[model samples]
Each structure stands twice: as structure tokens, then as C-alpha cells.
Target: MRLYWKVVLINGAVLAVATLLLVLGPFSVSRHPVVSEAVVLGVGLLVMLVTNSLLLRSSFKPIEKVVAEYDAMFERLEDERAASSARALAAQEAERHRIARELHDDVGQQLTVVLLGLKQLEQRVPPELADELAALRESTRDGLDDVRRVVRRLRPGVLEDLGLPNALASLANDFAEHSSASVRRVVTPGLPPLSPEAELVVYRVAQEALTNAARHAHADGVELSLTRVGDRVALVVADDGRGFDTRTDGDGLRGMRERARLAHGELAVTSSPAGTTVRLEVPSS
Candidate 1:
């Protein structure tokens, strides 16, 4: 039965017992002619009072325990989520470092050399073709902007300077601006800050989850949760979309789990006929 009903039933039983004692007091007292009726009635009432109090206390005790269990579960889930998210952030940061290294050694250097060659050609080109040359230069400038955008995504400037919260917020905002989907971002405050590695993991995990939801799941809604406990954190992303089969493994799921392992955490993917939930947990400082 429901908790409230059970409590009410317990209270009803207590009242019934008390009422029965009051109703039977006259007959029991009548049998005792030597004793005063008032004495018998007083003793019966005292017994009823004690019985009611004891039963009511017992009922409330179980309810208290139930509530405590719920609170404990919430805390554990939060811890796991935070740890998972931290892992994502760290992975993303590593990816950024790799991208930066490549860009600096390859693309950036090549682009610089190309720009120098264009400068030299500008001086030697025929006067009649100046218009076409200028257009070419403009095209090169546009390409440069595109490359810069890539670098920014690979190594989010905000990440190193502004920290995780701002970096996450910026990511959501930029993604929303660039994509057509309406993102529902839920970030709770007062969570203990994660380590740089932890932050990167969290971000990457979220990034993948959102991407899956948008690209594969065709989900209309996504939820991101970040919660903190004394020594752990949790990150959870749930989507209301076409769910996947748990029996089959995919790159997205494997990558997410790998990132979690990198952060000393774990990843769980729960999918049903109705929807899907990706949960991650990691430790916090």
C-alpha cells in the first residue's frame, strides 16, 4: 500500500483501540462493585494513551528511514555524474592539445608560407589581373577564418582561462547558435570544482552525448545534470528519443566509456523502447 495510506491505517488502528477501551470501561467497572468506576475508567484511558503513542512512533520510524534512503541515492548518483563529466573534459582538452600541436606544426605553418607567397605574387602579377588577384586574397582570408574557428573549437580559449563552468556554458551557447536544435541545459550551482582532467572528461562526455542525441537518436529533448557530494561528482545526460539496443555496441558508447576510464570513472548507458540515459561518475577533490 501507499505510505500515506499505511500511516493513516496505523493511526486508525490506534484510535480504534483507544475508542474500544473507552466504550468497554463502564461494563468492566460495573463488574468491580468494590472499586470506584472512576478508578477503572482512569486506568483504561492511561493504557489507551500509551498504546497509541507507541504505535504512531513505530509507523513514523519507517517513513524516516525511507526518506533517508532516497537522499543517499540522490547523492551517489550526483557523485557518479560529476566524475563522469570530469573525465569528458579531460579528454576534450587532450584532443585540443593534439589539434593545436598539429595545427602549429602543419596547417598554421603552411598557411603562413602560402600567405608569404601570395605577397610575392601580388608584386609580380599583371596590372590587368589585379581584380582577380584581390579576389584570391579575399578567399585566402576566408579560409584563414575557418582555420581559426577550428583551432578555437579544438582548444577552447575559455577552458584554460575561465575554467569549466564558463567553458561549458560557452560550449552550449555556441553549439546552440551553430545548430538548429533547441538545447535544454540544466547546470546546478555550488558544485565543487573538478580537476583539469576531470573537467575535460566531463565536457567530452557531454559533447558526445549531445551529439548522439542530435545526430543519431533524433531526440527532441536532452537533460544534463551535475551534482556534487563530499568526495565525488556525477554527470548524467538523458534524452527523449528513439532508443538504441543495449546488446549492440557502437563507437559513441565505446568512446564515452574510454574517456570515463581515463578519468578513473565509469559510464552507463541505459536504453529502453521509450528513451535513453547516459550516466557517468568520477571522483572529485
Candidate 2:
């Protein structure tokens, strides 16, 4: 039987028995009852209250068990989801590292060779061909630089080598150079140490937030700050520009959320007409 119906039935049966005893039993209350009669009525009422309590408790046991089971199930599912996300993110990073290595070792080297060949050929070429060769060499140099930039973005060797603080500072410099926005970077000294996963999550989230500020928000000024908050390290990126709705889930926002979940960090975004702020807090090592 459903819990609601079972409770209703139990309560109704208890009330019916009490009503019958009151209406049909030998126990009668006078308008002005004697002390013994009053004591007897009080004891009966106490017994009825005890009986009702026992019945209701028994009826609710199944529901309580079911709720406990559901709670455990949900907890297990959440753990599994987090594990899956971690695995996927790790694989993605590995792939990116491999691609960056190949680009630097193979494609980047080829471009460098071509640029050098063009430089050598420029000297030997006739006067009419000199301008064309110079332009071609410049284009080749630009392509090599572009490849190097892509490798840098894909691998983030700076993060691995210099740690989170310097990595973030580099990111801020890059953003300022590439975009119209002026960036202010603040990294608190002696911040708590973070696990590698936590550091990566923080870096990626900061990178995405700055990219959004540049590309979408058209922010003139951006601030990136990293500090220790209680036992956790916090990263905040704020911009002064037209804000976006936080309710929307673009690819970048979703990726940030997934990374935050993998690191067991908290991600919060507050946006208004004036600007937007993205904050991430991760446990310290």
C-alpha cells in the first residue's frame, strides 16, 4: 500500500476505536468530573497517544528505507560521473600534448626550413623577383610564428615548468597583447599549494574567462586574481564590459564547468549590465 494511504488508514482506525470507546464504553465524563474519573480519562488519552505514535512510526519505516537507498544511489552516481569526467579530461590533455609535440617537431621544423630557404633564395633572385621573394619569406616567417603560437596554446609548457603563478601571469600578458583589453594580474604571495589537477583546472578556467571577455564581452579592462580563500585557492577573472547571461551554456562555459567538477572545485559566475566575474575555488594540497 502507498505510504499516504497506510498512514491514513492507521490514523482512521485509531480514531475510530477511540470514538467508539468514548461513545459506547462504560467510561463517562460528568460536566464536573471527580478526580478519579479525570485521572482515568487522562491515562486513556496517554495510552491512545502512545499507540498512535507507534503506529505512525511503523508505517513510515519503509519510506525512510527507500529514501536512504535513493540517497546512496545518487551519491554513487555522482562519484562515477566525476571519475568519468576526470578520465576524459586527462585523455584530452594527453592528446593535446601529443599534437603540440608533433606540430613543433614536424610541421614547425618544416616551416622553419622553408623560411630559411626563402631567405637564401632572396639573395640569389633577380631584382624583379626580389620583392616577391621578400614577401614570400615574410609570409613563411609569419606562418612559422603562427605554428609556434598554436603549439604554445595547445601544450602550455610554461604551466608545467614555472608553476601556476607564472603560468597565469604569462596568460595575462598574452591576453593583453592579443586583445584590446588591458589586463591587471594579481597573484597572492605564499598561496597554498594546489594539486596538479587543481592547478590545470584553474589555469584553463582563467584562460577561457579571458578569452570570453576579449571575444564576446568586448571588455576594455580585465582583472585576473589568484588568492587563498580559507583552505582553498581561488581564481577570479573580472571584466569591465557588456556582460553575458550566466544561464546560457556555451561550449567554453560547459568545458569550464566540467573541469571544475573534475577538480571538485566550485565555479561561480555573476554577470550584470556593467561587467561579469568568473570565480573558481579548488581545495589546496
Candidate 3:
């Protein structure tokens, strides 16, 4: 029983014993009624105190066992869910890498051959057809550039070669080169290393945030910052464009959340007319 009920039972027992002693006092063995009553009351009080103390301690023993079991079950479920999420994320990344490789190797090679053929045709063609050949060559070149950009987006080699910080700088530089928007990166020096999965999460979150700032927010400039905050690392991407309400989760936002979740981290987004800021925090551990 719980302590509350135990105490109530003990009190009731003491009261009943005292009432019995008083009711039978007229036939008591002691010579004086007052002395007999004092002795009975003293004995009853002592028994009540001892029983209450003993029962209170023992009552919660079962409760402790139940609570411990519940805690263990909760942790087991959490670990299973985390494992499932990690597997899903790993599969997704593998698929992306495969697609990137195919595009770069198969489709990209075909486009290169087309460009080379166009160059040869331009040299051998008559002067009247030169303009058409030139136009075709230009179009093919642009398409090739687009394909390369898509391949880079799918699989960034810089991320594997130079680590996350340098990879982020490269991403920002590419974004600036392609878009009119200015991108500024602010990174703290000597940032602690992260697990590969954690690094991917941080990189993807920043990439998506920048894409939203350029495409959805129509921002002219973006600020990306990575810093150490005590025992945690924080990534913040902010834009200067008109922002949308963050209450809705678009595909980009959902993707960011999934990445953060798989990394055992959290993401927070705040938006206003002035701009939007997406922040990710992960434990240094």
C-alpha cells in the first residue's frame, strides 16, 4: 500500500486499541484507573509509531520495481526508433549517390560527345550554317553545365575531401556564383569534429535553408553561421528576404527535420516579414 493508506490504517488501529482499553478500564488489573490508562496509552502510542515507520519504508518497494521496469521499456523503444530512422536515412543517401554517379558518368559522357561532335561540325560546315551550329553548341554547353550542377548537388565531393566546414564554404561560394544573391559564411575556429552522419545532417540543413532563401524567400542575401555553443554545436542560416509563416512544413523543411532527427539533433525555424532563420543544434557528443 502507499504511505498515505498505510498511515491511515496504523492510526485507525491505534485508535481502536485505545478505545478498547478505555472501555474495559472498569475491570482493569491495575489498582488505579489513571495508571492503567497511562500504561495502555503509552504502549499503544509506541506500537503506532513503530508500525507507521516500518510500513512507510516497505510500501514503496513494489513501486520502485514498477517504475524501474517502465523506464527500461521506454529506453528500449526509443533506441529502436532511432535505429529505424538511421537506416532510412542511410538508404536515402545511398540512392542519391547512385543517381549522382549515373548522371555524371552516363548522361554526362553522352552530352560531352554531343558537344564535341558539334564543334567538329562547326569547323567543317559552310559559312551559311555556321550560326546554327554555333547556337546548337552553345545550347549543348549550357545543358552540360546544368547536368554538372545537378550532379554536384546530389553528391558533393568537397564534403568528403575537406570535411563539413570547407564543404559548406564551397557550397556557399557555388550558390553565390550561380545566383545574384550574396552569401556570407561565418564559422567559429576549431569547431569540434562530428560523426559522418552528423556532418551530413548539418550540411544538408544548410543546403536546404539556402535553397529556400533563394527560391521561396526571394532573398537577396543569406548569412550562414556555424559555431560551438557550450557542449552543443549550432548552425544558423538567415536570409534578408520576405519570409513565410513557419507554421507550415514544406518538403524542404520536412527534409531538414528528418536529417536533424537522424543525427540526434533538433531544428527550429523562425520567420517574419523581415527574414527567415533556420537553426539546427546537435550535441557535441
Best by lDDT: 2
* Candidate-wise lDDT, in order: 0.75, 0.92, 0.85
Model 3 lDDT per residue over 1-285, tens place = 566777677768766766786677654446655977688667767876786667655766778888999999999888777677768877989899899889989999999999999998887889999999999999999999999999887887688779888999987997898788899899999887788878888999999998888788888999999999887889999998899988787878878887888888989999999999999998775
> Which whole-number lDDT from 0 to 100 does residue 64 have in model 1?
86
| lDDT tens digits by residue: candidate 1, 107-193 | 877777776677678889898887777777777777777777788767766777887677767767765775565666666778876
TM-score of each: 0.56, 0.77, 0.60
Please tell me which model should have the higher lDDT, number 2 or number 3.
2
In candidate 3, residue 193 scores what lDDT? Answer: 74
Q: Give the Cα-based TM-score of candidate 1 against the true structure.
A: 0.56
TM-score quality measure for candidate 2: 0.77
lDDT of 2 by residue, 1-285 (tens): 987888889889888999999989889899999998999899888988999999999888888999999999999998788779778998998899899999999999999999999988887879899999899989988999999999998988889889999999999999989998899999999999999878889999999999999999989999999999999999999999899888988888888888998788999989998999999999998
Give the runs in model 2 whose Cα sits over 4 Å from its true position. Answer: 1-9, 27-50, 125-139, 178-180, 215-220, 229-232, 241-251, 272-274
Could you give the C-alpha RMSD of every candidate to the true structure, in order shown?
A: 13.7, 4.0, 7.0
Q: Is candidate 2 or candidate 3 better by TM-score?
A: 2
